[model samples]
Target chain A: MPFHPACHSYEPVTIADRLFLDLRRAILEGELPAGKKISEPELASIYGVSRGSLREAISKLENCNLVTRRPNIGARIVNFSIDQLMEIYQIREAMEGMAARLAAKNMTEAELAHLKSLVARHKDSLLHTERPAKTDYSQDADVDFHFCIIQGSKNQRLLTMLCQDLYDLVRFYRMRLSPAFSSTAMQEHELIVQALERRDGEMAELLMRYHVRASRDRAKQRLESMSPEELGSHH
Target chain B: MPFHPACHSYEPVTIADRLFLDLRRAILEGELPAGKKISEPELASIYGVSRGSLREAISKLENCNLVTRRPNIGARIVNFSIDQLMEIYQIREAMEGMAARLAAKNMTEAELAHLKSLVARHKDSLLHTERPAKTDYSQDADVDFHFCIIQGSKNQRLLTMLCQDLYDLVRFYRMRLSPAFSSTAMQEHELIVQALERRDGEMAELLMRYHVRASRDRAKQRLESMSPEELGSHH
Candidate 1:
């Protein structure tokens, strides 16, 4: 099977892989809570696993950038800040922009058609929803849109870097910033799809970069408007 | 101290970290050889460390993209491939392009001066060397030049992604493809430096992307000219 550019698609095969997925979900969903120190023994006992399995799981988490491990200090969940979020967007703007460009040149006609249908479905859903911003579906569909383009790039290294290493962090932030979707963002997605349909790599990259940068600015505005307590509160 | 965008700058503080560093050097220097299956028992005995420490070190290598671990097949050193090298260059073109743009706006005056001096030194070294292409000094200087700009971008996450995650693979390729340097690459560096000096982020990004793309083309040409045996040899 071709690799998909979303962490949710990863199938866990081993004990450590299962545990990593569970802990990853917990962190992204805010169930474990951000910036919390990991207690290896406590977690192992709670999960009815050995320390070795838990350590292995935590190492996987660290690879995903969901957990930070220091030499002397133990692992801590990644803390959120607007600055860090902006930094992430900066990366997305570059990497995803490249992905879009590659996809334009490389995506099969069937893939492009699939992408168009996906965007159309998203638009339909947004139009039908009573409160599109309040629904989690919009957020998920947004992720799917980005994932399709990234996977279409046909660059395995770029796919692994974005999907496995970075998208978990993206989900972590998106969970906190629920209701981040907007009609403007949808419009941007439509434009990107159009560029891809035309097979204009340059235009596709430009649109993707613009879309990511606009999202960053919107996220910054939303984050700035929130009080510290509001921003800190786990959803 | 600021985090430098080079893995060699990392200080190994723990046993596992030390092992990781040692093993990383082994892989990049081709002492371990490319595409070799890692034997935990053998490696642990050779390093005089426990299997657990060796496993930890291997895990670190996986994160650096130097090793690939399959569920049931075990870990193997990443095999060299022209296609994979091209993929990496595409990523670098996007990311390092963004780095140049950010550095133009974010780099301090001192950093700019330091960069200017770095280019001057590299140029001087190139002029004085009898066979500049064969010397490792040029490669190191080339790495340093890119590192300076990536560090100057002042994006901590970008620094980590490039330095910790991607550059090792870059070094792996460079080790096999040494004598890849040319005066053209240096001239490209000079243009990027000038753009940064003028604080022109757009121009800096344009020049940086062009440089990476050109380097990719050059590497492709050199690889094509080599015999399959020559390309596969672990230099």
Candidate 2:
């Protein structure tokens, strides 16, 4: 049937969907560790939902690769192998590069101004203290900067696909931003902004690719220092 | 839950899965056009499967975005808006470009040999056939060449994500190839192969991006000449 916008627009939120969203948030925030089994009955009771609703939520999670489901077995949180991580980064590098290129050509004046403000705010935050007690604001600003560029691309399909793949990994990337790294990222963002200002699509794309690769390198270095068990820990 | 290898190494195929695969193939092949509502009871009876099995299959299809499901309503194949089509091509250009670059660095000798053979076969087919007939084989060869590059990238995540997005539209692209266009595509593929052979990653990536943009331009030209209804007919 056609999506009957009326039905989708005002219908009361379903228990299954609510559960799915909550579970997804937990996974993305690293509250649900990798390799942990998620029991349906346990979740159903905790969420005050029926087993059927819980199963539906689990199915959606499985589709997102946030959870794995085996017939006659049970669900567990997903863990990426080294190869999978590498593959994910490779895809991200290309998609983000494209986003930067398009943003260079298509960003509206208002959007470009907003991006500049975001970068300025981040720079101010870095100067305020050697290390802030709360990194959430800075992180949010960082996300906004990237999100603006992706949205400025005016490519909703690419944005949707990349967001789905990258959401759960955002925290991992965020944790790698040390004071020194944050300074470097700020400088990189300035170059990206300059390229966008000049409408230099190729330079913008190259810079964005380099930024992502640099982040990936930092993440890899961090992972290399951790024990296997520590690396497997979600938080 | 991790994927469990089936006991006994093999088991009788389930009717539900068979129906699901058949339906998926039909959708991908454009036999079941986008925006067509799927009747569950009718499909169940036609496929000789239970209604429950049909529902399960529909759920999987919905996840793939091949079909859209509304609560308490039903499912229909998804149709892309013009904006969505443009966005899709933008993502494809980036992904195919990255795949070409990685393929240049990573293609095995055996895979390169296989790609050469495909090109040779298409050339042989061209020598004996008329314009349109020759074009058909040549387009098939183009698809195979791109597929080989994606495979050679050794990035499963990139391949899987791109496969999901491009599976249906590739048919539209294939249908638009003309004999003249095919010859040009062959020459482009030859240049891509030469870049790969020389391990010139930047050249390979640049050529692939240009090739995709050229294809997109052709698609846009064809789309401009056609009415909305005619475009819908292709789906």
Candidate 3:
């Protein structure tokens, strides 16, 4: 018989890794609302991790600007002020534009074919779907289309920074898509795809910037309409 | 009697924090160099930290895109290829442009005064100096001037991301600056200051973009001229 592997049955999960993934998912899914306090002991109990491990995880989040930690007070989810929102948009405008331009030049043939399929599926969904399905499918398609462009850019640093900055914002804005806005978004995606197909780098960059700015305006409008109570509760 | 603090008291530094700052400084100061392998046990010994703490720091640095960690193999510093560099500059062009635009609208009286003083001080240095000072005062001035614009924008997220991305690039490129470039940089700073003073957001944005692009070109030229051995040693 083969010798038993040493310590084969004793693999253990690291507390810090567990807490990092748990908190990241909560923020992405909006289970942890913006500006909510995150107590170390509370998180440690929930994740079955020690306080030391939880603190490490929170430090990582703070580094990403997903959470803010004070020396004595503990950590909280970050809430963007209006001015911060604008600044985020400025970075997004530049990054998305570069992604589009690079995608035009460097996207693989298979990636382009996949993007075409996504666009077609989205169009079909719009034509036959009722109320909520249309919005959901449109939002999913928007993310998939942009994801393709970013991957095509093949710039790891750019992709990483953009994902960290815009992940939550994209999720929040996607939930508020009106039919009018959805249709407009589909049209913008078509323009970007067409430019990429033609390998027109400059035009692709221009269209991508315009598309992000337009989406940002819609999000701003929705944010402005919310009551202070609603905003506070979310935080 | 009042209790006195214990003599010869020692506060133990956490392993994670020590590793984090050491790795961050090494990357920023080009000590480790781009594309160099980072061994965990080696770093642990160097910093007198444990493997667990070193891993935690590596995780954070990976999140920052300053290091890339593989599963079985360890981490390595990032080496951005030419295409990646172009993509980085494209993003910078848009962000620096937007920063200048925002700075024009929002720069405080005190900040404007400080910017003017920075320019005047640099001008005096250029007039009086016979050679480039052993220390790069120009780099300090450049950082201060750009930081002024970033702060004026009052966009925390934008400021944070730009600081991480472009600021590091600026520091890396500073090593290659010649006396000729120093004078040229001063002239460009004057143009930017004048544009800001007139409250011409468009011109300010345009000039800022031009300034960043010129810097990128200079850096590229310097990089191209170096032999592989020279590049390895320089980093």
Strongest candidate by DockQ:
1
**Candidate 3 lDDT by residue in tens digits, B84-186:** 6665676777777788888888888888898999889988877887876676466666777787887777666667667654555545434333423467777
Ranking of all candidate structures by their TM-score, best first:
1, 2, 3
DockQ for all models:
0.80, 0.62, 0.35
**Candidate 1 regions with alpha-carbon error over 4 angstroms:** A1-10, A133-135, A233-235, B1-9, B133-135, B233-235
Instruction: Report the CAPRI category for model 2.
Output: medium
Q: Which one wins by TM-score: 1 or 3?
A: 1
Q: Give a tens-digit lDDT track for model 1, residues A1-235.
A: 1125243446777888889878887888789988889998899999999999888889988888999888777999998677888999999999999999999999999999999999999899878877755545888788889989998999988888998777788788877764768999999999999999899999999999999999999989988887887666532
TM-score of chain B of each: 0.94, 0.83, 0.83
Q: What local lDDT score does residue B5 receive in model 1, on the 0 to 100 scale?
A: 24
RMSD of each: 2.7, 5.2, 7.9
| DockQ of candidate 1 relative to the true structure | 0.80
Which candidate, 1 or 2, would have the higher TM-score against the true structure?
A: 1
Top lDDT hit: 1
Error of 1 at B36 (Å): 0.4
TM-score on alpha carbons, each prediction:
0.95, 0.86, 0.81
Error of 1 at A111 (Å): 0.6
